[model samples]
Target: MSKASETAPSNLADIDSSAWSELETAAVSQQSGFRYVNLCSVDAEAKPQARMVVLRGADRSSRVLEFHTDTRSPKWLELSANPHVTVLGFCAQTRLQFRLQGMVELHGSGSDLAKAAWVRLPTWSRMTYSGGPPGDERAFEAINESVPSRLADEAEGEAHFGLLIFRVRMLDWFQLRRQDNRRALFTYDETGALAACRWLNP
Candidate 1:
């Protein structure tokens, strides 16, 4: 076998980092951001909706993932009615899929997190909030629905800028390999503490 093959991890027992830790690391990686996540939420009608979102932040200790969004988006309405949600991600490079279940707390307008996130946004990104609210019907030939490429005043975007914080309560992990597949489930207690980690046959 090649030297690299000889040193490769054969299974979870030899993993350099635990599942949660690896996920946290991936969430913050620029290379993984766009291809990283599919966030799921339940709407008022009790249907599940999934969408891709950039992974902006992650905290393993808190089991929390953070992302930015427009406050007026449909997701805000969906989350308002139900704070429960799931974040699904697959990293092809790692051959791993992660399904993270959690409750979300949204920060909008005056919330500290929202304010901080707003300050961090550049003017071009901030301009997205100044446009027509998300999901609004467009007249014939209506355009500029996306974030403006040019810089706009931060104040104009403040009203629509939102910070979404998802606190994970469980993690379901599945790893696909050439010779074998692996799966595991991790549950957390009420206090945001990991309670159990169990492996499953795949």
Candidate 2:
């Protein structure tokens, strides 16, 4: 978790391994406290949409990343039309930037993944799904009245909860240092296996 430059290895082999190691570490350990990434997609008119989403889980071998969203959100509609998406993330402390491209599938209400994720959410987070549809016109300004307060409504909230599974097709990794910078790209084949890994000038 130490971000200090003093801790980086001097060997190129170690640096190479660390690039992927960091990603795997981020996937499993939230305690390191760095899990947010920006997800970008295209809307109906082909306009770009971007927002921050938490990395709920990751499977490197499968090249998949997990995220949750409100089923009523516009992003869902966009994804339905076009599943392709990209995730951009940076670790300032480590001076690493990750740009990942992929396709996303949304699991809602009845699916096994969605059902499992919804079951684990805390009551407060569950309440968020109780609000009116996203972008809906609101007449009143009472924020507290927007969401259900009682735990009994948690089941009702599940109707709007959603789980997004992003299958990564490519990943570009970059490392920044005062002395030298390094970058690499990893592309996945149709089978989801790593097809190529190439160094890029940085």
lDDT of 2 by residue, 1-202 (tens): 3355557755544554565566677766775334888999999998999998878877666777888898889998899889999999898888778898989998988899999988877777788787579889876766645444576578778988899999888888777788667787778886677777777888
TM-score for every candidate vs. truth? 0.83, 0.85
Candidate 2 overall lDDT versus native: 0.79
lDDT per model vs. reference:
0.76, 0.79
RMSD of every candidate to native, in Å, equals: 3.6, 2.9
Q: Candidate 1 on 1-202: residue-level lDDT in tens? A: 2343234454543431466666666665667623458989998888899988878778767777888888889999899889999999887666677888989998988898888878877676777678678878977556734444454545667888889999989888777766667677777776767687777887
Candidate 1: deviation at residue 199, Å? 0.7
| The best candidate in terms of TM-score | 2
The window of 10 residues in a row where model 1 has the poorest summed lDDT is 1-10
Each candidate's clash count: 0, 0
